[model samples]
Target: MADDPFALFDAWFAEAKAAEPNDAEAMALATASADGFPSVRMVLLKGHGPDGFDFYTNAQSSKGRDLAENAHAALLFHWKSLRRQVRVEGFVILLPDEVADAYFATRGRDSQIGAWASDQSRPLDDRDLFERRFEEMKRRFEGQEVPRPPYWRGYRVVPAGIEFWTDRAHRLHERRLFTQTDSGWTEGLLYP
Candidate 1:
């Protein structure tokens, strides 16, 4: 298997999916506001490449706006089944328009419509109102392809540092980290 940090990410992800019983693709995403207040939530991991780790959401959403103002973010993947975890922190960049468009177009129709219907992170008066809007969108776009809304797109985290951890008895686990620097990737072992 590839040992490059990015390639290792793929390998671990695949292993997690096979071992995890549920929501294997979900990752804890952490982003901060300009004032340094932090927010964390689970979001689906959509894409990964040499460029970075990608996920999609409305740009106007709270997390989205926070990232827009502060271009750094972190991601954590914990697989209880495998007793392993990976943590990443890095600079974020917006995915190119074409890449976002392609991924959006591939989503199921209902999912695409849900993305348009949701005014994410905004106030919701009640469940009825929210579902009404969703139903309305479903009805209006029935049998037609749902177009990706302008507000929705993708962001990729270009990792500056990544760490992998494996659990062991007595908590004396293994920890290894890779950090990008002017000289290229620098690796080190961390005491648990």
Candidate 2:
């Protein structure tokens, strides 16, 4: 494996993309509140590079609120078909408006409208009310592009550490941990 964590991630991700049955970019995002409560949820990995891994969400959502209070987070990617997993820990940075707008533009019209209508992580009295709100948004955006809502945006996780794990027979797994330093990343093996 290369000494560069990003390079190793790219190689593993490419293999995952080829072998995983579906949603190879799906990852478990873990966040916590400033007070110490934790939350985990599945999110799609929208983009990744040396800068970090990116994902989008409603700013007022539960996970979003957690991120706002505590910028540190972790992500886990598991490829069942390949029996491999990658763990990433990082600090979150909100994406620029233009970047968010560009990604939003690629979404389907209905999804765009949903983004406008859904008050994610909020209480809803009834499904009918939600549906009506969605319908209203659809009607309002008729014959016009649905702009990205102010609260809808993307965030990048600038990794401080990364760990790669591979399954092995007799429960003897392989683990490689990479920690970022001022100069670059330093790698080491972990007992598994």
Candidate 3:
């Protein structure tokens, strides 16, 4: 077993990316407020490196604010078609402004504007209001460079714990857990 969770994650993720029919890069991001109330939603996995896993969102969004307050988060990747799932827990850090700027610039112009149009996690009057706002943003940014909003950027979750699970016959499963320690990583098998 590999002591590095990231290596194991990469292996499993590669398999899913090749075999999963859709949204292979999607993950369920979980966050909690300072008080410990939890919330979760699906987000696209944007980047990965030795530093950690990255995703982008508005800083004022619920998940973003939760991370700001607590700086801790969890992630789950489930590939229903493959009967596999991975769970991760970690500390989150805001990405540098330059990194966010580059990523935002790469986004479609309409999407860049839409980031400024919708107030994520806020109650909306109706779909029409959202459509109207989207239209307004489209008009405003038409034939122009759409800059990344100050409130929009990316966050990286530096994982401390990760568990990979795979299904088998009779409900038996394969489970491997990797946890970071002061020295390095500790790997173990879990009964499933």
Candidate 4:
């Protein structure tokens, strides 16, 4: 494996994209509130590079509120087809408004409208109410370019440590961990 965790991630991600049947970029994101209450949910990886891993969400949602109180998070990516998994721990930072806007512009028209219509993590009286709100949003933006909602934005998780694991026969597994240090990343093996 490469000394650079980002390079290793890229290589594994490419393999996953080829082998996984669907949503290769899907990951489990774990966050906590100021009081230490934790939450975990699956989210799609929207962007990634040396800088960090990015995912978007509604700022007013449960995860968002958790992140607002606590900037740290952990991510887990499991590729069942490849029998591999990657775990990342990091601090989260909001992406630049322009970056979020650019990505939002690329979403489908219906998705863009849904972003404006849905009050994520909030209680809804009924499915019909949501559908009605969606219709209203669609009509409001008809014949006009849908803009990114202020509450809808991306967050980048700056990793401090990353671990890669591959399953082997008879319950054996291979594990490699890389931790960021002041000088650079330090790699080590982990018992599996």
Candidate 5:
């Protein structure tokens, strides 16, 4: 049994990156509204460590609003080729503006513009209108570095529990769960 979930995650993620043909960093993020209604969507993992898993998004988006109202969330990474998955449950924390700014700077110019153009999770009456907005943003930032929108933000999830699952022969499997405590972390296993 590994003592550190983060270290185990690093190892498994590295293997997934090598084996998975597509985005190994992709994870399903589940967030709840103030009333505890849940929603889930796929998001790319921008960073991770003992601190937590990081991802960036538009703060006005549904997920953002949900996070604001309910700080708790869950993340799941499934690597089909590797036959492994990691589940993370934690409380969300807002990343510093500087962190968001730096990551925004690293984004491709088009994506940076899209972040500004898209009013995510909002009703869109027409697709062409969005295209026009995208073009308009491109011209608006022409010859200048596109800045992060006020609603664009970064978040980190400080994990409380992490479960590692692996496929095995037949229907049996392996399950290792690590739970956080005031002193540190406790590791245990579950029936496959």
Candidate 6:
């Protein structure tokens, strides 16, 4: 096994991309509100490295609101096909507007329009109402490139700790934990 957690993660992620039949980049993001209420949701992992893991969403959405209230989160990546899982705990950092704008520009036209139409994490009385808004947004941005909404934002979770787990016979799992220290990362093991 690689001594560095990031390197090990990179290798495992590569294998997952090839073996996982579905969205290999998907991950579960766990966050809490100011009042300490916790919530978890699936989000696509846009980027990752030693710096942190990156994802994007509407700033006014449920997870976004939670992040605003409490800038800490956990991420879980389960590559079932590979019998591996990784957990990350960290502080969230808001990415610049430029990053969100650049990513938004690359999205499909309908998705861009939907971003403007949907009031995510908010109550919707009727499906037709949202459909009308989608049409309205489409018409509003007709004959021009759709722009990124101000509420659409990107974030990174700067990891404080990371754990890598692999399955073993009889539930004797192999677990490796890496904790960020003042100088650098301290690698350790956990009974599993």
- Higher-lDDT candidate among 2 and 4? 4
Residue pair clashes in candidate 6: none
* TM-score, cand. 1 vs. native: 0.95
> Which window of 10 residues has the lowest lDDT sum in candidate 3?
1-10
User: What's the lDDT for candidate 3?
Assistant: 0.90
Go through the candidates in order and give the clash count of each.
0, 0, 0, 0, 0, 0
> Candidate 4 on 1-192: residue-level lDDT in tens?
357899999999999999999999999999999999999999999999989999999999999999999999999999999999999999999999999999999999999999999999999999999999999999999999999999998999999999999999987899999998898899999999
Residue 12 in candidate 1, Cα distance off native in Å: 1.5
For residues 49-155, could you state the per-residue lDDT of candidate 2 as single tens digits?
A: 99999999999999999999999999999999999999999899999999999999998999999999999989999999999999999999999999999999899
Off by over 4 Å in 3: 1-3
Q: Which ranges in model 5 have alpha carbons more than 4 Å from their true place?
A: none
Model 3, span 94-170: residue lDDT tens: 99999999999999877898898999989998999988999999898888899899999899999898888999999
Per-model CA lDDT versus the true structure: 0.90, 0.96, 0.90, 0.96, 0.97, 0.95
How well does candidate 3 match the true structure in TM-score terms? 0.94
Quote each prediction's TM-score: 0.95, 0.97, 0.94, 0.98, 0.98, 0.97
| lDDT measured at residue 133 in model 3 versus the true structure, 0 to 100 | 95
The whole-model C-alpha lDDT of candidate 4 against the native structure comes to 0.96
lDDT per residue for candidate 1 within 114-177, as digits (tens), equals 8878899999999898788889999988888787788897999999999999999999999889
| Per-model C-alpha RMSD | 1.7, 1.0, 1.4, 0.9, 0.8, 1.1
Candidate 2: 10-residue stretch with minimal lDDT: 1-10
Task: Let me know the TM-score candidate 5 reaches against the reference structure.
Answer: 0.98
lDDT ranking, best first: 5, 4, 2, 6, 3, 1
